[model samples]
Target: MKLAGLTIAYWCVLVMALVPMGCAWLAKAGQLGKPRRQGGFDNHNPRAWLARQTDWRARANAAQDNTFEALPFFIGAVVIAHQLGAVQMRVDVLAFLFVVLRLLYVMMYVADLATARSAVWALALLVNIAILFV
Candidate 1:
């Protein structure tokens, strides 16, 4: 179903776009309240701050980068699918699946489950490709 004439696939694109921000928040979780000198998130030089992250924080940051890398293809696929007159319901379902898999991938990434994360990433990529052809 569409909200304001935007299909679920389009909504999924918006959600996917925001996923990187959520990953960034996760990367900086728990350190935002302290002073910058005490290892808090640095609004100034944020890239340096994020680059200094380690462990799961680093993983979350990496996930953020990967999510950003994935976004353009997903966006293009949805747009092309719509322009190609692909079935809306199939596209929406695939897009939703892609989102779910990507979210799962992020969780697995943060949890340090490399094998599962890679698997989920592959699945989400396949889902995005399916959206292009649906």
Candidate 2:
């Protein structure tokens, strides 16, 4: 019953999913705010719409892509740690760190800081790897 609603690693997975949604929302909002949007929020072809962007909105789209790409590894690490009886407290802490670093990664991406964003991404990946080994 303790794992029903408050597992930290599970919450980390939920947050991981939500991160990309937030990026997409930022891109959509950014697109809608453009003074001369050639195409207004192309729900039917959003990737094409985003490809036409070249600023923060584009960065947001790219960040969303990176977030999605990172999910499988993070999810697998969490699941393996949980299944193999890794220390819950350690797993929870690493999961939380990964979430924090990933959020920072998104912020750095949207801010157009490529080097810092990569650093955050590396840190988040390290956290996931650590969760697996430690």
Candidate 3:
């Protein structure tokens, strides 16, 4: 049942799992090297550091949190779809679309495009739902 030796849908899941970390990296970008006392990223208390961010940094962190929230549903949908004997190509394509929409959602969030981001988030949610029944 493996597509190219490692189902494309599963590979999409792995890539989706990494998206939140990428958002975290975006939140921490360019402040990783400065001294903590000078407003640099604080590894000792990362959540504190992240909480103190503003503007796009804050949005990126928010995106990270949102992405994490979405991950479970996406994973569960993909797993359930496979277990239900869904068509492999259809599942794979839907999963891939979900990932693309999610990545776009992150970018729109960071760019302060509230409307577009919300729209993309809704679309991704629909895509995830489709994966469940594919």
Shift in Å, residue 66, candidate 1: 0.2
Error of 1 at 44 (Å): 1.4
Q: Per-residue lDDT for 1-92 in model 2, tens only?
A: 13676688888899998999999999889456544446667776777878897788889989999999999999999899989988989999
TM for every model, in the order presented, reads 0.97, 0.90, 0.96
After aligning candidate 2 to the native by TM-score, how far in Å is the CA of 85 from where it should be? Answer: 0.3
- Kindly report which residue stretches of model 1 are placed more than 4 angstroms away from their true locations once superposed: none
Ranking by TM-score: 1, 3, 2
Cα lDDT tens digits for candidate 1, 1-134: 79988999999999999999999999999998989999999998899999999999999999999999999999999999999999999999999999999999999999999999999999999999999988
Which runs of model 2 end up more than 4 angstroms from their true locations?
1-4, 30-38
lDDT scores of the candidates, listed in order: 0.95, 0.87, 0.95
Please write out the lDDT profile of model 3 over residues 1-134, one tens digit for every residue. 47578788999999999999999999999999989999999999999999989999999999999999999999999999999989999998999999999999999999999999999999999999999988
Error of 3 at 67 (Å): 0.4
Model 3 alpha-carbon drift over 4 Å, by segment: 1-4
Question: lDDT, candidate 3, residue 69?
Answer: 98
The 10-residue segment of model 2 with minimum total lDDT is 30-39
lDDT of 2: 0.87
Give me the candidate number with maximum TM-score. 1
Worst 10 residues of 1 by lDDT: 125-134
